[model samples]
Target chain A: MNSKTAIKFSVLLLLFVLSCALSLLFGGSETMHLSDITSQDFIFWQIRFPKTITAIIAGSALAAAGLILQIIFRNPLAGPYVLGISSGASLMVALSILAGNSFHVFSDFFIGKSFIVVSAISGSFLVTLLILLISKKVNSNVILLLIGLMFSQICGAIQTALEYFSDPNSLKSFVIWGMGSLANTTNKDLLLFVPLAVLCLASLLFFIKPINALLLGQNYAQNIGINFKQSRFYLILISSVLTGLTTAFCGPIAFVGIAVPILSRMIFKTSKQQIHLLSTVLLGSTILLFADALCNSLLLQVSLPINMITTFIGAPLVIYLMFKNKHW
Target chain B: MKGEAMISIKNARLGYKKSGAEISVLKNIGLDFYAGDVIGIVGLNGVGKSTLLKTLCGLLPPLDGEVRIEGELMTQIALSELAKKVAIVLTEKIGGFNLTTFDVVAAGQMPYTNSFNRLEKKHKEIIKAAIEVCGLKEHQFKLINELSDGLFQKTIIAKALAQQTPILLLDEPSAFLDYASKHDLFLLLKKLAIKENKCVLVSSHDLDLLLKYCSKLLVIEEKLAHLISVDEAKTDAAFLRIGGGFI
Candidate 1:
């Protein structure tokens, strides 16, 4: 690594550690003192620990997913939500909560517990599968992106229709989820998310060579012994799992997936997949923790949504990248 | 040609099918490509020159018939095994990458690396040789995206050379190059084919340059394919009729 990369990595590492500490220190009704351990510490431990870990997991997962999708598609705009994946999961969650219909409605036999997470994951996977099928048939990248946007719009329409008929109480709950929050998840949810995120990250590590090959373009990657279809399938599978998990625990936090990887690339000054992947994970966690802090500290009566903060930061970065670099 | 045929395609059919319409590009093409031969393929745009190269390199499956290497069908061979036998340079421009010119060339060794993407000592040696051969030693540490188009093209060629495969394929390698860069690339390709005993096939719009440099020629015309020795290609009645129009 060059000096520039080294400095960026160190700064990110420091931010990650500081954010973890800050997340543990401040939040909930009462803040805990650092010097003394008390019953309030247990409340802070129970409420804040899982919430903070969930944010970290969500951040790392989304950022890594976005990086992989962008590199594979060779489009900086490609992300977990860009291809209708988050919309699919969100729509499924909306249907389950707003319509009061159980997942068993889709299948004759189903277990009731963990149904929300399962349904969300399956919904995202189904949409990812559809995108993959379309990609195989269509050779144009712009057309694929347009199709993905259309899919997102269709899912949004369905979500809106469901919300229109929902009872007010269920609608309130669904709306809160839609705003995106890390506070609602429990330790059990963290147990579910942490391992899944780590496993997906591990699988992505195995794909470094293929991702590097992809930077040369698809035909060149294919010529270099990568089975394009198989590699793409694996990439989509991992990205979907990561996206699905984050959406399940924290709702669809927008733009973190898209923005973090691009930010990491600018900071590191390299497009190599390995460096981008690592930086994305760390940078994502740092941004999410900071956003969560701002959401907690600045809001008086109503806490600002995580999605709102991410969109605020992400939109300008997108504009800057587009205007400054024509080739990216 | 001192050894057995390295690549053989028999009774191949090339075409595109869209919305229930089938368009045949090339039909029943049979050919044997040998080591130490620099073959030039000349054809009009959309004449299936790229499709033929893709099929030979196993990028596309032949609609009909078979491609064989060392007496085995191409489809049955693993992708990694196929990569060891051939390498290709494409016409598309690459995006921004902070890779040194040497790192760009070292990517050719990906097929031989273990699953972790680590390069062995021998791989490093091959990469060094590739960089030296391309005359890019001074620019080895320069970022790939910063190089001019001519140097970038040379870097891609150096990457292919690093693969050290028995056969190499290039699609319009000199399409965007200056006259001097184009001349130097073709000369280097000819030298590599003869001195290293590798089979090289290239598609080109520069018919005059192809005629002067290539040992053999494959011409695609009217949905048919013809392979002829360069000497015979010069005197054939068909050649005189087409003349400079082939360019």
Candidate 2:
């Protein structure tokens, strides 16, 4: 790494740490003080600490997943959101948590009662498998993206049907989940969330070389001894796991995937995947932490949806990227 | 040719497998490429020039006959081992932006890298040597997306050279270069084949330049590939046999 990029990485990493600290310090109400927490460390561990960790994991996983798909598909606009993987995850959540005996699979129909993460993974995996099969048939990248949009629409309809049949409390929970929050995970849920997120992120790390090779083009990547099909399979596996698990634990937080990598590349001024990966991780974590801070600060009495904060920040950036289409 | 055969294609039928049936493009081809030969494939448009190149590089499987590379069957060779023996540059446009020319060339060192793709000092040296040989020293730090057509083309060639493969396959490699750059590319390929003792296969539409610089000429006509010497290609009936006078 050059001195300048190294300096940039250090600065971004520092900002990430600061974001983590800030996310842990406060939430919708007063600052989470050690002195104020007299009842067995009440709000800090229950709310802020796990939420901060959730922000870090969700942000980095989604961003890295987005970056990998973008490189592999050679489309700057591709992401888990646009590709329907997130919606598939969201659909599983809806079916498990909100459906409530409307469409029982068997005696144990509520996927949420046991292994919600696994159910979400199966949903995301199925969608990913369908997309992969479709991509093989489609010749154009644009058409592939359109098919992804189709998946998103179909999943959206199914989730809506489940919501329509749901009871009030279940509907309320579904609404809150759709709004996207990092504070949904209890300490009990973290037992399930952390290990899976770490595994997905590690898989993303292993793809650094193939991702870099993919930037040259698929045929070139294969020529350089990268098994293009296999790498793509792994990419789908990793990305689906990340998107699925994050959506399971922390709701479908959108736009961090598309926006963070774009900003990282624009700021770093390089397409090198290794540099971009590092930049995306740090920047992604920082952005989510910043958004969480914003969510806490803006309402003060009530926590706004994280999706609102991220989209308010991300959509404009994507629109700006669209105008600067040449770089994209 | 003093060296052993680098690649042997025996009665190979090449085609695309589309929709459960094979759409054959070329059939019954027998060819051997030596270590020190620059073989140029010349054909009209849509005449399987790129297909033949793809089949040779194992990107496409032959429909019937087997291809052996360095005495191993091409299909049976491991991907990493095949990478060490053969390299290819396609005409496809690359996507990533702001990649330095140095980065593009260093990608050739991929097979030699550790699991994390970190290059060793020796691998870095090979990449540097390739950049130097391709005359990209001044432009080495420039982003490939910002490079001129000629410089971009050089970056692709330099990448192939850094691969250290014995056989190089280029599909319409000179298609985008200007006349001067085209000649420079051909001369470099010629030098690499003769001095470096690498087998080079090139497919191009520049028959005149190709015939002059290449040691041999390959013509694809009527689903058959014919390999002939440049002197044999220089004969009076050669252009007529290609289906018309030169355009």
Candidate 3:
């Protein structure tokens, strides 16, 4: 790393630490104090701690997934949310939550949670597989992005139809879930979410050689001894897993996946996957944690949904980037 | 001077498959390529010039027959192994965000890098040597998106050089280059063939340049390909038909 990159990395690391600290302290309806010993422990351990950690995981996971999608698809606008992978998860989750009353099996708390996780993962995985198939026949970037948009529209229409028929109580719960949140994750959910996200994100490091080769385009990647098909499969698989699990635990958070990777690229000014990966993770975590903190600020009478805050911040960042770098 | 052919092709039908049908462009090709040979491929546009190069580089499977490299079947050789023997410079323009000229050239060393792709001292030296050879030392750190067309083409050529392969294949490499750079590129290919004993194949419409620098010519005409000596090419009927007005 050069002196400029080192300085930038150090600043990002510091920002991440600060964001984590602020998130833990002020991430609940009532801000908890570190000074008080007895009354604060319950709020800190149960509510604020899980919410803060969930933000970090979801942020970094989506960021890494977005970076991979951009590289593989060679499109700057690609992300789990935009590509319909998150909506695939949402579609399954809608089925489970809205129509789940008929199953009765989902009434059992532990089984229902696990089922939701499975449905989300399988939903996103199936969509990712479909996208991969279509990408083979359609090589143009604009066409692939349009296909992704079409997938989202189809999935959204189905979800709306499902919502129209479901019981009012179930529909209400599903609506809240769709808006996105980090507060729902308890310590138990972290056992699965943390390991899966960490594993998938870390494994991305192993494919650094192939991912870097892809920047030259697929044929060049193949010529340099990188297995283009295998690499693309594993990359999309990992990307979908990150998107699925995050959507499972914390609704479909927007903008972090799309905006953060671009931000990292802008900050670092290098396409070397190693630096981009690290910077994306750090910036992603920081942004989400800060957004979560903003969502829970005492100034608001009712706490806003996490998605609303992220979109408010993420959407503008994306628009700015699009205009700032026309080619990006 | 001929001893053993470095590459041999027998009855290879080169083309692509579409909707479960084979569309053959060049049929029943037989040829032998030796080290220290700089052969230029001449054909009209869309006459399977790129397809032939793609097939030679193992990007496409031939419809029938076989291609052999150093006595081993092309299909039998693994991509990783083939990567060590062949390098290519194609015509397509690539855009990689924040990718510098140095980074693109460093990719040529990927076949030799470790799992994490860490560039060792020796690898860095090779990358640097390639950049210098391609005259990109000053623009090494510039982003590829910022470089002009000629500089970007040079960067890719430098990448192929870093691969350090014995067989080099280029498809319309001079399409974006200026006149001076195009001459320099052909001269470099000639030097690599004669001095380093590399087998080089270049496809271009620059027949005059090819006649001046190439030892032999691979002419594709009417779904047939013929590999002939440059002197023979000057008198060949098909070559004259294609280059009749110019030559």
Best by DockQ, which number?
A: 3
Q: What residue pairs are clashing in model 3? A: none
Error of 2 at A180 (Å): 1.0
Name the TM-score of candidate 3. 0.96
Q: Chain B of candidate 3 versus the native chain B: what TM-score?
A: 0.97
Q: Write the per-residue lDDT of candidate 2 for residues A1-328, one digit (tens) a residue.
A: 7899988888898898888877877754778765655556767768777888888888988898888777867778778877888889889878766444456543552344345677677788788788877877787867987998999899989888888988888888888888889988777777667787787777677888888888887788888988888988888888888888888887888889888888888889876788888788789889999999889988789888999999999989988987885555
Regions of candidate 3 where Cα sits further than 4 Å from its true position:
A36-40, A98-100, A107-110, A133-143
**Model 3 lDDT tens row, A150-176:** 998999899989989887987887789
Docking class of 2: medium
TM-score of each: 0.92, 0.94, 0.96
Instruction: Please say which candidate is ahead in DockQ: 1 or 3.
Output: 3
Instruction: Please tell me what DockQ candidate 2 reaches.
Output: 0.66
lDDT (10s digit) by residue, model 3, range B112-212: 99988899999999999999999999999998888999999999999999999999999988888899989999999999999999999999899989999
Worst ten in a row by lDDT for model 3 chain A:
A31-40
Q: Model 2: residues >4 Å from true position, as ranges?
A: A34-39, A98-114, A133-147, B1-3, B236-239
Scoring each candidate complex against the real one, what DockQ results?
0.62, 0.66, 0.74
Candidate 2 residue lDDT tens string, B1-247 = 3656889999889988998899999999898888889999987788898888888778998999989998789999888778888899888766455678998899999988976888889999999999998889999998777788778888898999999999999989898898888998899999999998999999988888887899988888878888888888867354446636663
Candidate 3 chain B least-lDDT 10 residues: B90-99
Q: State the lDDT of candidate 1 residue by residue for A79-173, as single tens digits.
A: 77778889898888776654335434534222322566676777788898888778778877678879988998999899888878887877787
Interface RMSD over true interface Cα atoms for each candidate: 2.1, 1.6, 1.3
User: Deviation in angstroms for B155 in model 1?
Assistant: 2.5
lDDT of 1 by residue, B137-175 (tens): 999888777888878888899999888888999988898
Model 1's C-alpha root-mean-square deviation from the true structure amounts to 3.0
Which consecutive 10 residues in model 1 chain B have the weakest lDDT in total?
B238-247
